[model samples]
Target chain A: MVFRELSLPVRLLFYLFLIVAAVSILYPLTWMSYTSLKTNEEVMLSPFGLPTRVSFENIAEAWQTGNFTRLYANSLLIAIVSVVGIITISTTAAYGLARYHFNGNRALFLYFLVGMAVPTQALMVPSFKLMAILDSWAAALHLPVPLLNSPLAVILTYMSWSSLAIIFIRAYFMSIPPELEDAARVDGARELQILRHVMVPLAMPAIATMTIFYFVFFWNDFLWPLIYLHKHTLRTIPLGIMHFEGKYVSLWSLQVAALSLAAWPPIFIYVLFHRRIQRGLTEGALKF
Target chain B: MANTSQAGAAIPRMRPSRFRLPPGEAWRENLYGYLFISPWILGFVMFLAGPLLVSLGLMFTEYAGFKKITYVGLANFEELIKFDIRFIGSLRVSAVFAFWTVSLAIIISLAMALLLNQRFKGHTFFRGLFYLPAAVSGVAMTFVWAAMFEKDYGMFNQILRIFDFDRVAWLTSIEWALPSYIIMRLYGVGHYMVIMLAGLQSIPDDLHEAAKVDGANALALFRHVTLPLLSPTIFFLMIVGMIGSLQVFTEGFMLTQGGPARSTLFYVLYLYIVAFTERRFGYASVLAWLLFLIIMGLTLLQFWLARRWVHYESEEA
Candidate 1:
């Protein structure tokens, strides 16, 4: 028999392997989630055992002690604002680059694609210097505050370096039939009117997919925020959780609870939009 | 009624327009095109290009601070080659990590994708479950894994006890620490699985059937037909995976802290320390350039190898 007609024993083994793999992937995460629902005493007593009593108080205390509400607000603000900027900038640029054939169009598209290879860390030292320059520029212009230690600082960096988003969005725009734009133009719609009315609506799915990607990316980001924002109040969720973990080393239950709380938002989104996110991820990467 | 009707009337604007967009393709198309991408161009020039050039310059110099940047022609690179033991060791660690992680991730992902491609019960659920690790926050995931890899109370050790194996110090033992990271990386195979699945599904099913008709067994079919078609996808994953795994920071940073004996000190992590902790931006820039060259070399090498291995269907036709 051909290997295509697998015997029962082999197929059973395949199922077993898949089960083992799935369990290996999920058990630890579920264990951590379960650990969060238990008391500190319970966790100390039995690390592997299920909670004797479900405790809501652990999560509550974690929220209060970690200042997660404040951190959440900060993270939500940063993620939303940055994603907004990313969507706007990425969509416009993607639309323009994908549709309009200006001179050096291919070169400009190549420019963004090639930028993807330059590791973000390569720009660190210089980015620090550039931020300093911007800070002084802000100061000299008599701005309310220096630009370095603010959400805007991170937003500007994210917006400028959203190459992946641009690639995906541009692909989406390219996939769109230019016939729609032509039809709109024939009806007295200007270029702005065409983009705003037609292309934007057509490319919403890719745009939304990119929004989720960027939002989660910014939400989970540590390095930039770590280097830039020093103020305790300005700390994003990851920073706050890091600090919380450091300070409350023995509070494993509370830390786990905090982590679960922090983990939920992104996981929730990923679970909901697994298909779209996965598809978009592959489309961009597979373009090469 | 007349007064009300008169009140409803509003005046029209006198000005034709405040701003005219230069009245041509310069305004409409080319201008907007440049306008749209102006941010990226500016960012490329200021952030990417400037830093890249500055880093190149600083490779031969010592940039202590802005004003303290002294010209030290090739001293940084020479010192690194001659003296920096940690630098050499970190490179070794990064290479090993990248070599194992990328290959293993790709291989396992392909296996899982093949399994997932089968028509079976609850495969979708299993697929999503596998991808769960990638969805979780890096810091939080590390912490959970940190907890799981605990010597005394960790999940893996607990499983070892159940199987009558000795509870191994997964993260503490010098021998097991790197392996522990590899294990941690395995859980996220779901990501590459998704990509590979897409590629697998894109291959027409009739090709497999046709190969079978020609007396090609399943293994032979996969070898001659499926493998060649999948090569492009695998190559893509390897390039991305190599670049990413080389710069792995969040994992090693949180879990091992490049632990037991600088065993896990990644190249980027080392660069981070030199730049931030030690404030050796000049030396850091040298490391960055070295990193760039290494990645570029490997990527070019892969492209060269792809000429031998990767078979695009388009090229075949």
Candidate 2:
């Protein structure tokens, strides 16, 4: 039976269940924020209790001591650079795959699609070795930064892992009618111009999804940074927050505040474009 | 390949004068395609395929970091299969964690999808609210759970103390650590729920209406129509969830560090320890390949099982 046709009690039960689900998801976040404002003594006395006063003391302390400003800058730089590179590479490749009639086009598309199933975890050892090898090569060529412990290592890793982006944008491009591109071609427009003018504006929605998806992916990435970025000055948000917890083992308020800072970007992004993010999740999964 | 060739054949018919063009047209098209995809091909080779081949070779040889390498044919596999207690323990830990987490995620997320699928006011708000956790960064999410599961002053213990129960060591005790890890991982299943909700929406309303018109009750309608239709989504979630669960690292690394007694030594965490901390790159390569094969096997097995239960509309008579 349709939900509207259900008995009153059944409908009420569904509402109750949904309410509980929402609370379970949201309460931890609210609890975290409020607890960050509490004093350590207050937290010890009543761990589950609300803050007595709205205090900026803990957040301020954590920000300075945890080195969050530097971490945020590093994280933002890496995620932004990697995302720009990924989009540029994937969209150009996806357009070609979607619209071209070349030999082995199908083979090339499948080749990328297969990379999606290979987990990054499985490549850790060899990736480390590869980075070491690249470091020597860079040093021989007298490049500025070594690939071993620099941010470049993680950024390059992030950029290289764009199979999903290629696949997603290719599907979106394929959905666009070929007639639009044909029309542009008939006007004597070059392929790049048509891609820039005709295809991109129409593909903004899919691009937006990819931006959110990869931005969050690179931002929250832990293992690669944990491996490649050993220098404290180059630490990203996830690495910084992790070491924050280790440093402030006994200071609950500071730890909570640091975590709250780390959570803000993703939460802010979610609050802003949650509708697209949610739809994107389903579209990626269902379409795959 | 045949379908793609057919599509390619359609291009010539669309442009009648294309046959009069020089042979360089096809060559130019091929060059353009190759140019566009060259970056991906370079990345795939250097980052993925090259590493894969190197790791495959390393799986047999005894190669430590920059140290002289020795050819130890079949020895790593023999040790892992026979004498490595820690490796076996890690496999068991990963299996138990995957089993419980995937099963619970499917049940909880499916129930959530079913609940929100019904028409109700504020359903959209609730969907966003429920999914908000999945959007939180993993490290941030882990810290929040760490605070909640803290022993002396954490939220769970504080609430338990209100009822005068003793504080349980959530991340410390051996028996409790894995369960705590599972609980923390389950907090991020909101994305899975959204996927299931999408699946539910795709099922035609006419099917439900037709079932009701046949004098079916709510349970019968759900049983006969909803279950079959949603099986494919469930199957998808099951395989994806299991694969992710088997490779879980952040929570274990952050919250427990696979400690108190290695009760939470997830497979990936152990691999990290072996590869990085212990500097046994060759041995870790063996572990990495094993994990990959395990995931591949489970995925293939799930796909094989799905043929019996997963109902696709295209397969219907």
Candidate 3:
């Protein structure tokens, strides 16, 4: 066969390459899940073997022992609240940047874009110190709940760090046809009305994409949560599992099960909505 | 800032604005624009700008564990250069890790992207499988990798036994720890691959078809057509990948603690220990500044080099 056409052997080679790639990707994940189900004796005997039985016992034990039920509630609230906050903030900002032609708009767009580069490590100390000060200030002011170990700290941190979503959704808004907006304008639709009725529907794909990205990011994030979340009750899944593993390092099955439990939510979300996720990731990567 | 605001005020009055709404309508539009973007600006001022300024101020002072602060005036940086052996060691480790992992990850990502860009059965499933690692919990990924690299009774060593090879301490030994982590880090390549796939899709098929009709082989086609076309994407990934790998922290934080004779110590991990563990906020600010400077220098250097090689669609005929 010629260069443009694939021959049998070459096609088979491509298939083989894909199989190898897939295995490399899926192996460690399956390894974790399988190891979680295996007994300690079985694990020591054969680390790579499939579990002899498919049991819910490990899942149940990890949930109860790790206090994942409460952690899950806390993590879910933080993630959901953070995503909503990010979307609302970013959508407004992105809509302005993408649709409006005001003065210094480009400069403003670039300003928000700087969020992608401001390393969290650099902000770690200052944010911790700021939140502590805020907590005390709130306490002195007789505020209901202080900001230090509260979910507001995590949510605010995430919202400020959401310039990536702004960039993403802006690109999406930029892609929509200008004629659609013009048509709505001709019909005497106000700006807010056009945004709500016309533009929002057109931008749903992009919004859905950002929704998935922000959800996963907020859910899976470790460093910020570790720094800000001090209370045992406020601990997220990763934090709880981390401390649990430290205490029970010798309990292989429980530790593995906890890790599996910690990894599941995002993985489940990713699998269910991979098409949108892939689209979002690709566009973000391409645009950047 | 004042000048820019004045200029912003001046621009609309002399507008080439063909579809001019009334003055009141125009004023309202500007107000709405400002209102819409207000949240980000407010957040940036409160969270980012304020903290950034505080961090810069912290770099000059000596503050330990939220106690009394004393101004030190660049002494932290001076100590980093003159007396901090662990800091320098971690820098070396991070540089090495970034070099090997970023380049290898880029290549692996490109290769997978090329493979996935082809039309095949189960393409979406394969792509999804490859992209799996990006969504995984960082702590969970670290723990699983820690298990996989266990010295004894690990999956890898069990495989090595088949080839009559002795087991190696993947994460525990100095020689193997960095490289083992590099392998684990390769799992992140799928993310970059998806980016590459996006870039590849943007390249028109006719270019490849023309190259093929010109009697170009697959290798030649990739070299002349695909490589040049994908250069910008490659350059983008290079900058992002380098910046990311340079700030590597999670592995050492969650798994290694920069052990095995400090072979696994990363720049941020060491900084984290200073700030959070030792509670030296001022010194950690110094570390943050150094990391920022190193990243800035490298990013500038990449941009300079990119002028020599990166191809842009707009630059050509």
Best by TM-score: 2
Model 2 chain B, poorest ten-residue lDDT window? B12-21
Tens digits of per-residue lDDT for model 2, B1-317: 12222333323211211122235356657776787788878877888888988999999888877968888999999989889988888889999999998999999988888888877888888889888888885898898998789777677888789999989998889988889988888888888899999999999999988888899998898889999999888888889898989989988888777787788999999999999989888899999998878776766666566556554331131
Model 2 regions more than 4 Å off: A5-13, B1-24, B162-166, B297-317
lDDT of each: 0.78, 0.83, 0.81
How accurate locally is residue B123 in candidate 1, as Cα lDDT from 0 to 100? 79
Off by over 4 Å in 3: A1-5, A39-41, A182-190, B1-26, B296-317
**What tens-digit string does per-residue lDDT give for candidate 3 at A1-288?**
232388879888878878977887888899898888887777767767888977767778888988999999988999999899888888888887776656677787766555666786778899889988888998999998778788889888788876888887877777676667666666777777877898788889888999988888778788888999889999987788789889888888888889999898888998899888888877666554
Q: Residue A68 CA error for candidate 2 (Å)?
A: 0.9
Model 3 scores what on Cα lDDT? Answer: 0.81
Give per-residue CA lDDT, model 3, range B91-123, as digits (tens): 999989988988998898998888888777787
Pairs that collide, model 3: none
Winner by DockQ: 2
Give all TM-scores, in the order shown: 0.90, 0.93, 0.91
Summarize candidate 2's per-residue lDDT along A77-123 as a digit string, tens digits: 99999999989888888877876666777777766665776778999
DockQ per model, Cα: 0.34, 0.55, 0.50
Error of 1 at B40 (Å): 2.7
